[model samples]
Target: MQIMDVLAKLGGESGFALFFMQGGWKNLVMIIIAFVLLYLGIVKKFEPLLLVGIAFGCLLTNLSYFLGHGENALYHPEIWANFLDPQNTAAYHSYGYIMKNAGLLDFFYIGVKAGIYPSLIFMGVGAMTDFGPLLARPKSLLLGAAAQLGVFVAFFGAVLLGFTGPQAASIGIIGGADGPTAIFLTTKLAPELLGPIAIAAYSYMALIPMIQPPIMKALTNDKMRVVKMEQAREVSKTEKIVFPMVVATFVILLLPSTAPLIGCLMLGNLFKECGVTERLSDTVQNALMNIVTIFLATSVGATMVADNFLKLDTIKIVVLGLIAFAISTVGGLLGGIVMYKTSGGEINPLIGSAGVSAVPMAARVSQDVGRKYNKNNYLLMHAMGPNVAGVIGSAIAAGFLLSVFG
Candidate 1:
């Protein structure tokens, strides 16, 4: 009788019982998805810097539902739900209560909830960026603005599909092909959609190499793609130092909502260009950036619980996000074509696609495509103009949307 009792107790607490009996089939599906994402990040090297952490987080969070109850679990959905509403004081209190009771993932999620990680990431981006190409060819700013056509286009599409205005706006910003900007905007406008929206934004961003090329080819003939731009003029150190301040002042005065993202961006740029704060700039670019990225990616992934992520809404978000990215690429390509004709074929139509703000990746694509046609043609520097401009343009677009809906 004693042996039978001990055997029954062990069977009740077995791993098989814990996994199969605790959570439903959805947990198994989510685990499979997590493993697929891990394969993409690890074996395929698809944005491994963030995707690995994200996949691991997803795996841990999903497994938590079955692994144990109470404090042993990595995430607690009931506790997290209370913190989703930013405007509710009681929700904030509940968040505090849950944080004290829950595991460590809840603590790290504060960065996502309070909107600190995106700003820090922007600071790192600014520290690493060079605005010399943009300063040399200010006309590239127009191409940046043109790429934002997709944001509004997707906004209307989302609204037509029956999403609320704030939700539509949050969904549309994914077209900007900017992860941090998308996260920043979605957190403000449609916090409920944060998980899907963020995943869509980063996933499309990683697939830029595959997505933009086909669009570029379909839109332009070989002659246009091969068009070579004149060498950009040299910008002085004084101009570099002054550009960030002027841009920050002008943008903040025009759209105060952009202050958090744009202000941190300019501050980081100032640290880099001033030539006096090398230590600060270095830290912001490397150490602080990596630390924040780990926290941001992991927390964002944790938000993808089986119930939230497996809905039809997530499928819609994925489709809409793809549409947004493709449209933005088309917008940039068309803008490049116009510039090419205006410059009498001196501008490469390929460079305009860089305006979608995938940063050096989009610009590098332009270079690769241009080189395919004319080996001597180098569009990298020229593409950089619109590449950086897209960053500012997306932030401004986010600001406008925030003002309207937030």
Candidate 2:
């Protein structure tokens, strides 16, 4: 009996005795959630480029205690958080990570603590994206604007729920279907909510085909799906090259704050346009973009550990994210329908759904749906107009929100 008691005492003393800050219930739940995200990213290939890196990071961040790292919470910047420490005061006055030893959060905070990395990612994105489609069809810019009705509408919805104006705005921008925009806005507004907002934006962007087709089919009859579109006029190489520069200058002059983001996006297009910079443009679009994406994804997921994301708001963010995405799709589809009616159906009604900034996926869905009923239907060229416009419109809406609630 004495020997057994000593053994039990040692077991209790050396292992598994720390009280979980949030309790075992939340701990178990969060681990399972992280695991699911992992499976989705790994096994299912759902946005593998991002999801995998994020999943791995999340797996690490969630274990309040993992591999003897000795963490009991996400982080504790308490020396500074305490606000009364002499050593910390001098430390706080200095620039950069004085509280580096505080906890696991220090690293996650590195990616999102300031708005720096997201903006860098945007520069890379700008260096990659092509503005040719929007340039070829300027009117599609109007459709992009229309699709943003969802961003503002969702912003209001978040506000009614007691989020600050900036926080609400960050959540709503996820509807823009642009990952960098979501990250950029959240970095300014609610950095705490970054994980959900980014996860939602990227997830839904990848799921565009899944989310959109049901909405599209319901809003239009079978007859509308088969409506043929006029062939897009041949775009001159000169026109594609000049389009990004013109749009960028016009936009920055109207809304200078967006210049950092919008400027980069257009600049990338310019690289593609100039022809002389084909090598640079190709490198930006391919290699540089992929590297940035991996960094962005891993850093974003590192924020998703159990402590931050297992809250009620995480669920709210996800649920509201879907709502926001649905709204954008409807807005785009309605815009397309109106355009079709106004143009006497010359525009493929299918192209309207591409107004969500899911880029090529939404555009491809338009083609797929069109082909479903009409085998010879080729809607890809037509869909490019609104597809490109959606990116610009999303950026503008972000600008409007930041200007108002920023």
How does candidate 2 fare on TM-score?
0.86
Candidate 1, pairs of clashing residues: none
Runs in model 1 deviating more than 4 A are: 1-15, 18-23, 66-71, 84-89, 93-95
* Candidate 1 residue lDDT tens string, 201-310: 88888899999999999999978876778998999999999999999999999999999889999999999999999999999999999999999888877877776788
Candidate 2 lDDT over residue span 127-210, tens digit each: 655665666677777677777777877888888877788888998998888888888888766767877888888888888889
lDDT at 203, model 1: 83
Number of clashing residue pairs, candidate 2: 1
Candidate 1 residue 216 Cα shift, in angstroms, is: 0.9
**Global lDDT for candidate 1?**
0.86
Candidate 2, residue 344: Cα displacement in angstroms equals 1.3
TM for every model, in the order presented, reads 0.94, 0.86
**TM-score of candidate 1 against the unseen true structure:** 0.94
- Pairs in steric clash, model 2: 126-265
